[model samples]
Every structure is written in C-alpha cells, then in structure tokens.
Target: MPEAKREAWITGVGIVSTLGEGADAHWQKLSAAQPGADTTTFAPFVVHPLAPLNFDAQIPKKGDQRQMENWQRIGTYAAGLALDSAGVKGKPELLSQMDMIVAAGGGERDLNVDATILNGYTQAANPAAFLNERLMGDLRPTLFLAQLSNLLAGNISIVHGVTGSSRTFMGEEAAGVDAVRIALSRITAGQSDIALVGGAHNGERPEMLMLYEFAGQCLKDKFAPIWERGDKGGFALGSLGAFLVIEARDHAEKRGAKPLARLSAVVADRASRKPGTITETLGKLWDKIKDKVKGGQTAILSGATGSTQATAEERAFLEQHGELAVRATATYLGHGMEPQFAMNVALATVALAHGSLYPPSDQTGLEKPMSGSLDQVVVTGVGHWRGEGMALVERVG
Candidate 1:
C-alpha cells in the first residue's frame, strides 16, 4: 500500500509593508481601510514606502545590519519574524533543519556610480575605456556579490540561523508563487517537515523606477485604487518584506504549533498575454481549485498590480467569479514585485485566521463587503507582465 500524503499548514507569517509590521498591525490597518501610500516621496511617481522599522529588534547585530542593503535587511528581518511566530526563533534544532526558499529580484543599483558612468561616458574621448575604468574603479568590490539574488537566503541563514537547504527563485511575481508552491509541495509529499518561504522588495529606488518606466509600467502623479486606474493603469512600487513558516501537519502538531490556515492547493501558469491569454490561463487555474471553494464562506485576495493590461485582465477574471468577495491588495499595499504573491498569501492566512474579511477599498463597486464567517480564501496572482497563479487557503479546524 502507498503511504498517505501529508498536509501542509501555514504555521507562521511575518509581514512588513507600507501599512506596518506583523499580522496584527496589517489586519488593523486593513480593517480600518487606511492606505499607507506616499504620493509625494517619489512624486510624479507614486510609491508605498516601507513603514519605519527598527532593524536592531530582529537583526540584533549592527554589523550584520550594516553590510546588507535595505532589501536584504528587510528580508532577513521578516524571516526572523516568521521564526519567532512559529515558536522556533531560538530553537537551535529547528533552525538547523528548517529549509528556506526566497523569491528575490536583482539587488539595488548604485545611483551615484550609474550617473557618473553615464555623464562621463558621453563626454570622454575614449568612451569605451572610460566606461571600463569606471566599472572597475567606481563600483565597490562587494556590490557584485551583494547583487546576487540568493544573498537574501544567505543573510537569513546568517542572522536567523535557518541553515537548512536553501533555494532562491528570481522571476518577479512568478518567483513568489513558485516559492510557496514548492515549499508546500515538499511538505505535502513528506520530503520536508518544515520550511520558511517568502520574499521582499524595496521598490523606492530611482533606477528601479526608471527600469519599469522604460516599459511604461510605473503608476504616476495621482494614486488611485487599482480597479479605478482603468486606461491610465500603472503600478505604485511598494517596499515590503513577507515571509511564512509552513510545516507538515504532523510536524507542527509534534512541535505544539497551531496552524493559522491550511494550504490546500497552489497552481501557477504563464500565458503569452496576447489579448485574452491571461483570462484563459486564469480560467484554467480557477478550474483546478474552484471545487475547493465554498460559496458564502470564501473570499479572494487579489495580487493585481495596477499595470494596464494585466490589471484589466485580472479584473475580468474576477468578474467571472463575482460571487466571491474580492479585494485587490495592490490598492492598499502597492506592488512589491517578487513578494506580491507571498504577501497576499500571508494576508489570506490572516483573514482565514480572523474569520472575517476587511471592507472593500474600491469605489468602483467591483469589491463588495463580505460578512459572516470566512473559512477559505483564494489568493490570486496575475503578474503585471507574465505569470498567473492561484492558491487555496482554508481555515484549520
């Protein structure tokens, strides 16, 4: 006889975003319908800056905090929060064995170095040599190493002692979806007993804004609810850190850890995004998990970055399943790139644990108020440009 598959539970969640830190703070902010966006900081371009965090609380070592860039510090801090939430913070045994998966983008660029290179290269007689010289001299030796996406996982291991197997995924929104999917898959298959998974993004950089602006994807000037962006759609880059501690049901039970919610299913897909492709891909993903949803007790936490075409397509997909109460988190939290999906999943776990969904922020009437007991949440991630994914998070009895 074949051995039965194990179940995966969301045992811990650590989130820090524009709204605030931890599950309680976020829940309170959402419940009150207050957005934490900053339209003036990076003006003409709107951004949701991270709430002020005292890094010493989680990182402890000032040296560790100093060496890491802002994004690394955010991710490591969030990972520590997850460990604390899971009751494994100082447990050497658990820390030694807890596997880790992170979704990350390339590290922040040095604006000064970039500006110098651009300004000098255009004026220098030997532009090629000037560029090469600047590349060799102007860039810090450690900048190259710091830019590696896996460094976030490495920093978590160093600071939090989560030294188990580590894997890093690097494709923006899809990376966040895959990180959770793989972590849950490993636990459910009994290959792993516990894992820490999530990602972080610092979207307040000039270079990052410019990079996205090149593609015409940055939300500018006025900040509007994601659904209201309509034809003038773009994403307000957000700075956030999100991490979750997921464990096998038996493992959590053995450790006396209570689950916030059960991760029942996660499905990810990529469509060409040619007109109706996203809607079609989302339809297929929905079909796989739709049966797991119970009407009246279910809601959706949508990871819809206000990027033009993708947001519209996601809205269309949500319209197809109008019965489910929907909330586009990007409207409040802003878009945190690689961490968007994980952040939304964490929010879903929060909602299921609380047994209620937050009131809608949309004035367009697309998002309606949900009442009564909330037992399940279908977290949707329609990537700004590429991937589409969904997860079913259910209340644990």
Candidate 2:
C-alpha cells in the first residue's frame, strides 16, 4: 500500500441493534454481556430482532417512511443518527456535499405476492404461463422499484439531505468492508474529504430465514454465543443498522469536529473458499497492518458469524495472534450480513473512545479480558461465504 497524503478520523458513529440505539446504549449493554437473541419466535432458527423504534424520531414524514421497506427505514434512521452525532444534521451547507457509500442487499421480497404465485403455480394447467401471468398481474410496479439495491442510498439521500456522489455495493458481508475501505481510501487519497459509509440488515423476515435454511447456514433450535456453536456452527441472523461518519483529519479540524477514533488501515479480499484460503487471506491482510500495532494495548473485535468453516478458520488465524485480547462481537450482536463489518468497526471506535474493551461473551476461552488501557483495535471481518477484511482503528490524539 502506498503512503496516504492525509489522515482519516472517525468523527461520528450511529448504530441500532438488538441492544438498542446509539453508541452509549450499545456500550452499556455489551459491557454487561447480554445477548438479545430470540429463539422461539422464529422457532428452530435463532434471530436477534431489532429493538422497538419509532421511525418518526429520525424520519419525520409519514409518506417518506411509508414508501421505504423496513431495511431502508432502519438504514435511513441510522444515517440520520450519524449525521446528528457529527453535529451536521439539518446543516444545509455540509449536508449538501457529503458523499455516501452503502452496502446493501437486493430489495425485500413481497411475501404475500410470492406466496400467492407459489400456491397457484402448481395447480395451473400451464405452469409457466400461469407463473408469468401472476408475476405480471399480481405484483405492483412499485414493488419492483422497491427491490432495487441502490434504493437504500437513494432513501438515505432523500431523508438525510445528503446530495453528494453516492455508490452502493451488493455482495453480502464483503460489501460492508469495501464500503468503509473505499470511503477511507478516498479521504486518504484526497478524492473526497468526508463520507458516510455503512449498511443495514433485516434478519427477521421469514424469507431470509428460509433462504439461509435451504443452504444449511443458520443456527437452529438454540442460541449460543458464537464461540460455542459447536462443529456444525451456524449464524443466528440479526437485524441491525450501522453507519459511520469518517472525515479527513484536517477537514474535520477545520470544521471543529472532534474525533472518535483514527481509522488507520483497511484491507479486503475475496478468498476462494477452498479449504485453507480464508486463513491465508486473513493472514495477508493482517501483515499489511500488523506493523502499526502496539503489543499489549491493542485488542481485536472479530466479526465471526459462527458459521462452521469460516469461524473455525478465523479462529486458526487468531491463534497466531493470541497475545492480543479478542472478542467475537457476533456473540452479542449476532450476524447482520451486509452491516456486520461496519458494526464491528463502530464498536471498535466506541471501545477506543472509552479506552477499554467490552467484557468477553464467549465461554470457549477463545475470548479473553483486557485489563490495560486500550489504544488500538484490529477488526476482523470474514464473510459467511466469500470475503475477508481487516481494519486497524486506533485512539486518536
């Protein structure tokens, strides 16, 4: 990696998850080691549901809220919170020029329409024609528009008044890594001064659970902390929204914005999942940022999703760095797919700001406590299927 001309600082963070909304609530609840997973509602498959939220707080217009899907609303509310935390909300001068990068999944399925089609298709004399007819007749045109992945960025722009350039990435967990990586790189390379980057996941939908279930990738029957999920480990889906306002250090200083943490280095890779590739990819990413690490003061915030192979491979890599205190955040937040990396990065920033690591939530002895003052954090993100990324977030000044 070439030397950066500027420094990147995380000036603001906004997140809503099973614990609640905002950084303080997350910190307090995570510190207490509480996991908000609900196993019975979805039965067999476990999930961490989003806490009760009044969308009116962040999105005032009922019409605007009505048009967006639950995922879009969750993301828009989080974006508004990030702007608020940065003290730039409603400030037309700044809002008009702030760039945005969002990691998102395709539009949500209209279950009612999908079910109606599925039920009628099997009984029809001509299945293909019947399917096409139902798709054309029963599905509204607006539903197709709503399924567009880029709509999250559009909704955020409409709701938060962010009018700068916008880009959206769509590859599940990998998307979150690249969103932050590109934002940080742009600020460092002088392509942009400030940016809003993150994503959201709504894991409570029956479609999502059914989809993952078909692939045998979801935790079923009971919810255990990530580390103890056993050999056939699977992820417990979680509903969450995470956004971070990262700005060039000088740009923030010029605007009188305070820094929450310094975003030092971000490295991402899509390792072909052939046996040991994930471990090798993670190691290479670690080598890129390992030199900046301070021995005892640095802790790791892992985005391990509790999937069998992925989580185990990440554990192998972590074993090599046993000197650092490690905490697998999925134990509490569960896995939020597209937003998991951003949430872990936000949690790391929150921990760095407080100068301490949150208590470990695992029982396998894989997660250890940190007694010394925290200064730097190395975040690891291994997607449930394909991507691998690592970022170094440190205490600023």
Candidate 3:
C-alpha cells in the first residue's frame, strides 16, 4: 500500500512592504483600499518603497547589520518575524531542527566603483589596462562577499538560529515559485517537519531600475494599477521582504502550534512565454489542484508583475476563469521579483484568516468585490520573463 501524504500547514507569515510590517498592518491599509506608491522618488520609474523598519529589533547586532546590504537586512528581519510568529524565536531546540529555503537574486553592485571605472575608461592612456587595474584594486573584497545569493540563507541561519538543512534558489520569480513549492512538497512527503521559505528585493536601487528599464519592463512617467497599465504594461518594482513558516499539520499540532492556514498544494512550470505559452502553462498548473478550489469561497491572489507579455498572457488565462474573483497584488505591493509569489501567498493567508478579501483598489474591471465568505485561495505567479505557477491555500479552521 502507498503511504498517505502528510498535510502541510502555514503556521506563520512575515512580510514588510510599503504598507507596513506584519499581517495586521497590511490588512488595515489594504482593507481600506489605500495602496500607495512613490513615483517622485524614482521619477520616471514607479516603485513601492519599503516603510521605516528598525533593524535592531531583529538583527540586534550592530556589526551584523553593518556588514549586510539593505536587501539582506530586510530578509533577515523578516525571517526573525516569521520565527517569532511560529513561536520558535530564541528557542534553540525548535530552531535547530527547522529547515530553510530562500529565493534570492544576486547581491547589489558597488555603483560608486562602477561609476569611477566608467569615467576613467574614457580618459585613460591605456583604457584596457586602466579597466583591469581598477577592477582589481577599486572594488573592496567584502563587497563581493556580500553579493552571493546564498548569504540570505546564511544570515537567516546565524540570526534566527535555524540550523537545519538549508537551500537557496535563484532565477527571479521562478525562484519564489519553487521555494514555496519545494517547502510544501517536503512537508507533505514527510521529509521535513518545518521550513522557512521566502525572499526579498530592494527596488530603491538605481541600477535595478536601469536594468529593468533596459529590458522595457519598468513602468514609467506615472503609476497605474497593474491591470490598468494598458498596451505597454510594465511592473513598478517593490522594495519588500516576505517569509513564511510551513510545516506538517501533525507536527504543528504536536508542538501546539496553531495553523493559520493549510498549504494544500503548490504547482510550478516554466512557460516558454511565446504567444500563448504562459496561458497554457498556467492552465496545466491550475489543473494540479483545481479540484481543491471551492467555488464561492475561492479567489485568486495574483503575482502578476505587469510586464507586457506576462501580464497579458496571465490575463488571457484568467479570462477563462472569469467567475473567480482575482486581485493582482502587484497593483498594490508592486513587483518584488523573487519574493512576489511568496508575498501573494502570505497575503492570501491573511485574507483567508480575515474571512474576506480586501477591498478592490483599482478601476480595472478585472478586480471586483468578493461578495462571499473566503476559505480557499488560488495564488497565481507569472514571472516577468519565464515562470508560471499556482498554489492553493485553504483556511485551516
């Protein structure tokens, strides 16, 4: 006989966004349809800047906070919040056994060093030699050490004391998809009893905006909701941190941990993104758990990054399921790349716990009033470039 699958439950969620910190703060703001973005700060490019946060509350060590970049500090702080939410913070016994999965992107670059090299190359007697000399001597060794993607996991381990098996995945939005997918899968397969999963993005950086702008994916000259961005839709990058604590249901019960919600299943795929590929892949992903999605109680919490092809293709897929109420969270949180999917899943859990979806904040016909009790949530993730994924989160009680 085959072994039955163990249930996965979301015991805790920690997210810090432009709206604020924790689930309660976000609920209060989003519930009132007050989603704000800073258009003037980044100017031509819109961004949802992170709210004020005290690193001391989480990292506690000045040396630890000083060595890390803003993005890492954001992630480490969020991880501490998740540990606290799970009732495991400072408990070495529970933390020592907890696993961790982080979705990460490359660390920030040294723009000052880059600028010096760029200016010197034009005026140097030997441009090539000047470039090599500056590259070797100008950039600090510690800067490169801070750039590795796995350091987020390392810092989380050091700060929060989650010392069990650790893994970090990269590849933008797809990383977020697989991070949660694998965490839920492991819990369900009885391989891991508890795991921390999520990522962070620092969208306030000039280089990021420049990079996305080059790809023609940055929203410019005015901010609009994701759905209403029209023909040339683009994503407004968001500066935020998101993390979740997922564990086996039986294990949570044994530890006297209350499950905020059940992670029923997670499915992911890399869509070729040509023509109708995103729509087709999303359809297939939805099939993996469509049976568990209850009609009136279910709604879609979309991580639609508002990039042209991706947003349009995801919309095409959503049109097929027009009956399902959909809220593209990028309309509010903006798009935080590797962490967007996890953030939406966290939002879904918060909404489910509240028994109602937050009020609509956009003029787009796509986002409508829920008009029903909430229980099941279908969180959709469509990477700006390649991935397509869906996860089903259901209310525990």
Candidate 4:
C-alpha cells in the first residue's frame, strides 16, 4: 500500500496525569485553567521558572504509589481510559486481535534493582553485612515489576484479552511519536486492524527535574531566578500519560465508532540535537503536511514545551502561515516529556472532534495568541476563530 493510502482514525482515548485520572477529568483540567499547577513546594532548591511551586498538583490518592511505580500507574491508567473511550472496555475478545505499542523513557530509575541486588549479594556473604546493607528491609518485588514499560502493555492486554503482537520503545522525548509511527506502519502492512499507541514519563523523579534544570528549560516567571538571568518562558515539570486508539476509518465506521479526526499524516525526522535544526525539522514536518493541511486545518496543536528554542521555532512556523490559527495544549497539560507529543495529539483530537479549544495556562500578564492564530503564539479560549475544525492541512513536501 502507498503512504498516502494508509489511513487511521482515533476512535478512543485515555489519560492519566497529575490532573488526576480518567478522560473526563483530563478534559476538564485541560479545557480550563485548573488551580493546581501553581502550588508551592519546599522539597528541594531546584530553579523552577514557575518555581516556589504554589499549586499542590502532585499525583492523586487514587494513584496508589504504594502498589505501583509512577510509570506503571500512568501507563495503565491512560491505557484503561483509552480503551473505555473506544467503548471496548472490559471486552477481552475485541482487543485480542489488536497490536499494542507503549512508549516511555527513564523507565524505572527510582526503583533501582541494581542497588537491591548488590545489597542482596552482600547479605548472603556475611550476616552482619545484611544489617549494613539493609537487606532485611521489606523489599517490594512488585515495585520492580511495575518498572518495566511492557507491563503497561501487559496490564491492558490482560484486561482487553489482547493476544496479538506487543512492542515498547524508549528515546526520551521522541518515544511517543515513534510509537505512533510504528503502530501506523503495522496497520498499513495489515498486521492488525487496531492499536493502542502512546508514551509515558514520570516528572515526580529527581532525574527528570535534574535534567530539566541542567538544560535550563523552566517556564519563565517574574520571580524565577532564571528569568532574572535572562532565561525566558521557563518550563514546568509534570507527568503525563496519553494514548489513542488508531484504526482504519472504514473499520471504525463499521463498528459504529465516531472518529475524532482522520490521521491524515504523521512524519518525523532527526538532526543533531542543537538549537538551530529544531525549526528545520518541524519545517520538514510542515512540508510533509502542507498539502494535507492547507485548506482543512484551522488549529495546530503544538508540542512546544515552552523552552526557549522550541517556542521560538514554533512561533516562527506560525509567523509564516499568516491566518492559520494555533492552539497549544501543553500550556494546560503541564511540561510534557516523553509521549508529550502524544498528549498534544490527543488534545488536537479533542478540538477536532468537539470544536472546543482547551485554554492555556495564564502566565501572569503575558497576552499570547492561541497557537491557532496565524503567525502567532495564541493561547486557547482567547479570541479563537473556529474554522472548519477539520485536519485538512497538507504537508508541502
């Protein structure tokens, strides 16, 4: 089959994040500015652009950290919601024929099995060393099991009776999109009629925070020290799990499914990880999308993480498209890491399906345009000019 001939439509979705679990809560949190992202925290002296963390937006009680690793909690919760959205919940027979693809990075760093093993070895060698190694401590084997990314697929498969092929990928921020490409390719090749595609990452870890800080990528605020030092649009740290059910359009319709939007096209490329080529890569994506998007799309759900380089390039792309409106959901979803783009794709599906824009996080007095606006960084719920609300924009390769 040809690339253009391959078609996929989203029939369902699920999300699990600091905004709380379930699709309804996810929609509510993103559709409006929730009062949680701004809470203050005194845990560590990390330089946050919106630091002094005023909102108490940590994981909710239902998350049950004692039973699952952060990644597993996010992955499973999101997957369940996606299956529910597709109306395939609790039906193992329907999912048994589908393929599964899960994405994530820094998988289970906090659940360090290496340290545990080292302690175990020392304890076996010397009984007294057990005390020093804390080998007798209550070690939760379940914690280690929860750390594997595949367990995410396993949980969903067991619930849905998905006995077909399964796969997982890792590459930090790029894993989410890669998972989509893989799933789409498999369907195009007739490997399966449906797929559960998504990416998962945890922000509650010190590594994600450390990496963000080292990169100097916090969202800018009036009080952030990084802002005073000339850093702008500082990024926020938050967790996200986003998944979509991708199936052929005809198949979806035959099953009485309402598609959010047609997966008309998806393309990605990589250059050296530097500031200069990010725009070029996105431009390449635009090129591939130009013909498909030109007359059909009125809104662009950007993966802009509010970092200096990404935001600048995205702004440049919008600037060239004079009159094409843009809507960035990350402003509301918090700083998305791996599978971040998947979350944005989900938000786009929501807008395309419902014709409603999810509002952006208010950055004090900053009056930005909803990325939906032509050549501007427009925020959502401002003066959004709702167009046809279809994903018709084509890539101009």
Candidate 5:
C-alpha cells in the first residue's frame, strides 16, 4: 500500500479534562500556557504529577460524582461531548452501523482503590449495613460494574446503541495509533460507514503514576507551572480526551459534514532495543511512508511524549522525513495522563482536522532545527494549523 492510496477524514472533536469542562474550553486553555505542574494528593499513594495533569477530572457539580467510578465518569463525559460534536445524537441506525474502538495504554482499573473497597464490602456481614457503608463511602462497590476497564467501549456502545463492534485494546503507547489504523482499514474496505474512534484516561490514580515512575516515564524535570514548569517536568500531567468521526469522503460530503483532514498513514515499527534503535526505527517508518505525506497539505503530527527516548525516536523521523518539515503539538495539549497514548492520538486527530500545530513545551526545550528547516509551531496555542501540515503520507510499500 503506497501513500498514494490511503484516505480518511476527521469530522468531529471532543475533550474533557482539568484544562476545561468541554472541548472548546479545554482547547482554549490548552492552547495557552498556565500552571500545569503543581502536584496534588489524590489518594494516600496517588500523587498528581501536575495541576492540570488530571485533565480527566471535572469539578463535580452539586451531587453528580458520588454515583459513578472515576473512570466511568470521565470516559462517559468526554465521549458524550465528542459524539455531540460529530453530530451523533443517539441515533439508533447510525450507531448500529458504526463501530466503537477505544484504546488505552495503561491499567484501566484503579487497583489501589478497588482493593480498599473490596476489602470493606467483603467483610461486612449485614447486607443492609454493607449497602449503607457503600452509601456512606465506607464499603464501595466491589463489583463496581461501571468501572470495568473496558467500560469506555461498552458505555459508548450502549449510549449510542452501537451494535457493530464494541471492544477495548490495551498496549504500548503506539497502540492508540494502531486502533485508528485498524478503524481506517475497516472503513476503507467497506466494512462500516462511520467509526467512533477515541482515547481517554483519568490520571488521578496512584498505582498508575507508580507504573509510570517505575518505567522512568516521569517528566525529566521539576518545573512547577505551565508558565514556569516547562523546564523541570518535560511535560506536565494534563487530562485530555479526543474523538474523530471518520467516514469515506463521498459519505462525508453527502452528509454535509465539514471535512477537517484526510488520514494519510500511521506507521509503527518495533522500538529498537538498543540505545540508538529508536532513531533507526523512526527512520524506517518515515522512509516507508514519506510518499503518503508528500505533496499538497502534508505535515507530520509528531507523537511527542516528552520522554527523552520518545523525543529521540520522533526526532529521527523528522530528520529523515524532513522534506515536509515536521511539527509537534503535545506539550500544547498537555500530558495524555492515564489513558496516555489514547488521549494523545485523540488530540492528534483534532490537530489534524483543524490544521493547528502546537509547539513543544518549554520544559523539553524542543528547538526548531537550528537551521529552521522544519516549519513548527514554537509558541503556545498557535491557532489552526496554517497550510496543510496534515498530509496524506504515502502508504508503506
């Protein structure tokens, strides 16, 4: 499949996080720099790495949060907004024909919280007492049917009455992109008319942060705020949710939905095990798909995770695929948080649709090639991506 044959488009957007309650608010604050790294205590072990880092959270209005688990609340909240933006209004017909493919990169369940609640509920002898304890916050639902890891997909399917396909995938960060790639394949092959593709995560869980730290995935620095923390933490923890409505060009046009950008290609190669293998892997992916992103309205939407390793990998891709002058926007959208990679891809889809590129955060000091060859958004929230950085990269041959 050469880059010349790939095709897909982004027709909607949605987000819910600390940055803002809805997509527009979230995007506005995300586009600007602020105090994003102030740490907050979630549970005993859970330490929120940054202020806006837990963008998956919302300021529960009045009495809205006590009924749902944290994950369910956030996933449902964000997906609903995304569907609305995509013009999906709980239509039974559209949903039954559409697919729901949601992916995440980390543990979907808050293990620490689960253990605490399950222990309490199991020990209570009186069912009424146990129920009362649960209501009183002492014995939580051990079988919190709402918080199952795959609830994102399940809830989306139920909310929209989607009967086509409902499942979740958990893998490496690159897995988020893989989910979209799979969706594109199904749609292009004429298996479906519309696909609801999204990524999300609630970053407030302690166990999740521990995993990140254990893997040496924490931001490299200790900067404190969105304005000042740019140097300390390579990227602060920030909540993010993104969804895109992808349909065949003809179908989109017939439905009168605005087309943001067409999907070109999303290529992933095994990360090299060696110190410099990332560079080589990136180069290979670029070489394999450069033709797809070449020509009119083409640009690279880098998966800039801010980790030195991730940065190096993407940097190598730019060097080899420099003809189009790549650009990055993650630091602008904030950290992907819990469902790390899924949220990143969701945001990337939006970035592609709007053609707005975000500059790397000041924390990592992602410099424009000293030669200024690659056109990048080096400042905070530069409006819509100027020109078409969203290129239909040539497919891998």
Candidate 6:
C-alpha cells in the first residue's frame, strides 16, 4: 500500500510591511482599516514604504547589516522573526536541519552610479570606453556580490544559522507562489519535515519605479483603493518582507510546535494573459480547491496588484464566487511583487487564527464584509502579468 500524505501546517509567520511589524501590529492596523502608504515621497508614483525597523533587533552584527542591501536585510530579518515565532531561534539542532525557500527579485540598483554613467556617457570622446571605465572604476566589487538574488537566502542562513538546503526562485510575483508551493509539496510528500519559505521586495527604489513605469504599471498621481483604480490601474509598490515556518504535522507535534493554520492545498497556473485568460485560469484553480472550502465559513485574501487587466479579471472571477467574503490586500499594503503572495498567505493564517476577517476598506462595494466565524481562507494570487495561484488555509481544528 502507498504511504498516506503527511499533513502540512503553518506553524509560524514573520511579516513586516508598511502597516508595521509582526502579526499583532498588522492585525491591529488592518482591523482598523488603516493604510500605510506614502503618497508624497515617490510622488506621482505612490508607494507604501517600509515601517521603521531597528536592524540590531534581529541582525546583531553591524557588519552583517551593512553588507546586505535593504531588501536582503528585510528578508533576513523576517526569517529571524519566523524562526523566533516557530520557537526555533537559538535552537541550533532545529536550525541546522531546516530547509529554506526564498522568492526574490534582482537586488537593488546603485542609482547614483547609474545616474553618473548615464549623464557622462553621451558627453565623452569615446562613449563606450567611458561607460566601461565608469562601470569598472565607480562600482564597488561588493555591490555586484550583494546584488545576487540568492544572497537573501545566504544572509538568512548566516545571521539566523538555518544551515539546511536552500533554494531561491526569481520571476516577480510568480516566484513567491512557487516558493510556497514547492515548500508545501516537499513537506506533504514527506521529503521535508520542516521548512522556512517566503520572500521580500524593496519597492521603494528609483530603478524599480523607472522599470515599472516603462511598462506603465506604476500607480501614478493620486493613490486610490485597488478596486477603484479602474482602467488607469497600476500597482502602488510596497516595501515588505514575509516568511513562514511550515512543517509536517507529525514533525511539528514531535517538536511541540503549535500550528497557526493548516495549509491544505496550493495550486498555480500560468496563463498567456490574453483578454480573458486570467479569469479562465483562476476558475480552473478555484475548481481544484473548491471541494475543501465550506461556502459560508470561507473567505478570500486576494493579492491583486491593481494592474489594469489583471485586477479586472481577478475581480470578475471573485464576482462569480460572490458567496465568499473577499478582500484585496493590495489596497492596504500596496503590492510587494515577489513577497506579495507569501504575505497574503501569512495574513490568511493570521485571520484563521483570529477567527475573524478584518473589515472591508474598499468603497468599491467589491469587498463585502463577513459576519460569521472565519475558518477557511482561500488566498488568491493573480500575478500582475503572468501567474495565477490559490492556496487554501484553514483553521487547524
């Protein structure tokens, strides 16, 4: 006979965003429908900046903090939070065996260097050689090393001592989906007993804004709630980090770890993103997890990036399942790209543990309120351009 699949539970979550740090602070701010976006700083393009964090609290060594870029520091700090939440911090035995999966974007660009090169290149006698000289002379060697996507995972392992196998995925929002999907798959398939999975995005950067602006994906001018963005849809970049400690139920039980929520299923799909592709892809994903959902007791935590077609199609899909309560978190947190889906899953676990969904903040009438007790949360990720995914997070009882 074949061995039965092991159950997977989300035992710990570490999250830091514009709303604040940790589960309690987020729950409190979200419960009050308070948003933490900054409209003036990156004006014209709205952004949700990271809340003030003291790196010393999680990363003790000043040298370690200085070595990493802001996003890496954010992710490493969140990973430490997850380890602490899982009661594994300082437990070298557990840390040594814990596997890690991280979803990350290319590291932050050195804008000053970029600007200097751009400004001087056209004026030089030999533009190519001038550019080459600036690239070779002005940029520090350590800057290139710090920009590697895997460095976030490396820093986490170094500072937190999580020395197990490490994997990093990069594909914008899709990376976050796959990171959690793979981690859950490993645990349920009995290949992994315990794992830390998540991602971080530092969207408060000039290069990021410029790149997305080229695609016309940055929410500009006035900041509005996600659903209200209409045809002028664009994502308001967010700076945030999220990490979760997920383990096989038996493994968690043996360690006396308390589960915050059970992660029953995670499904992902890539659509060509033609006119109606998102809706079609999401319908197929919803069908796969619908059987595990109890109509009235279930709700949705959407990772809608507020991009024009993507948000609209995801909204259409949710409208078909109107019986379920829905909240598009990007309205509050903005969109953290690589970390968006992981952050939503963390929020879903938090909502399940609290037994209540935060009140609706959208004036668009799309985010209706829920009355009864909350038991299940279907977290949805319809990537701004390419990926669609869903995961069912339910109360552990």
Model 1 stretches astray by more than 4 angstroms: 1-4
Which ten residues in a row are the worst by lDDT in model 1?
1-10
lDDT of 4 by residue, 1-397 (tens): 1464556777777766666665566677666655345434514422212212111122234434345565666666677678878987666666877778887764566436446666576648675666445533534566556666677777656545666788887665566667776677676666668888886666666666655667676543332311122235555656778888888766777788877666665555555536545556556666655654543235555555566655665556555665554555555555556666666666666555545455544443222344332211111110010100112311111
Off by over 4 Å in 5: 2-6, 21-23, 30-35, 40-68, 105-147, 224-236, 295-299, 319-328, 337-397
Tens-place lDDT per residue, model 5, 271-337, is 5345566666555554655543433334454545555544554465466544443445454444563
Give one digit per residue, the lDDT tens place, for model 6 in 191-310. 999999998999899889989999999999888889889998799999999999999999999989999999988899999999999999999998888877898999999999999999
What TM-score would every model get versus the actual structure?
0.97, 0.98, 0.97, 0.74, 0.71, 0.98
Question: Which model, 1 or 4, shows the larger lDDT?
Answer: 1
Q: After superposition, how far is residue 194 of candidate 4 from its true place, in Å?
A: 0.3
Point out where model 3 deviates above 4 Å.
1-4
Q: How do all the candidates rank in terms of lDDT, highest first? A: 2, 6, 1, 3, 4, 5
Residue by residue across 356-393, what tens digits does model 1's lDDT show?
99999988989999979999999999888889999999
Cα RMSD to the true fold for all candidates:
1.8, 1.1, 1.6, 7.8, 7.8, 1.6
Identify the runs in model 4 with alpha carbons over 4 angstroms from their true place: 20-24, 33-36, 42-67, 109-142, 218-233, 295-297, 359-397
lDDT of 3 at 363: 87
* lDDT of residue 336 for candidate 3: 96
The lDDT per prediction is 0.91, 0.92, 0.90, 0.57, 0.50, 0.92
RMSD of 1: 1.8
Report how far off residue 350 is in candidate 4 (Å). Answer: 1.0
- Cα deviation at 55, candidate 2, in Å, is 0.6
Q: Roughly what TM-score does model 4 have, to 2 decimal places?
A: 0.74
lDDT for model 4, please.
0.57
TM-score of 6: 0.98
lDDT of 6 at 376: 95
How does model 2 fare in lDDT?
A: 0.92
What's model 2's TM-score?
Answer: 0.98
**Candidate 1 clashing pairs?**
none
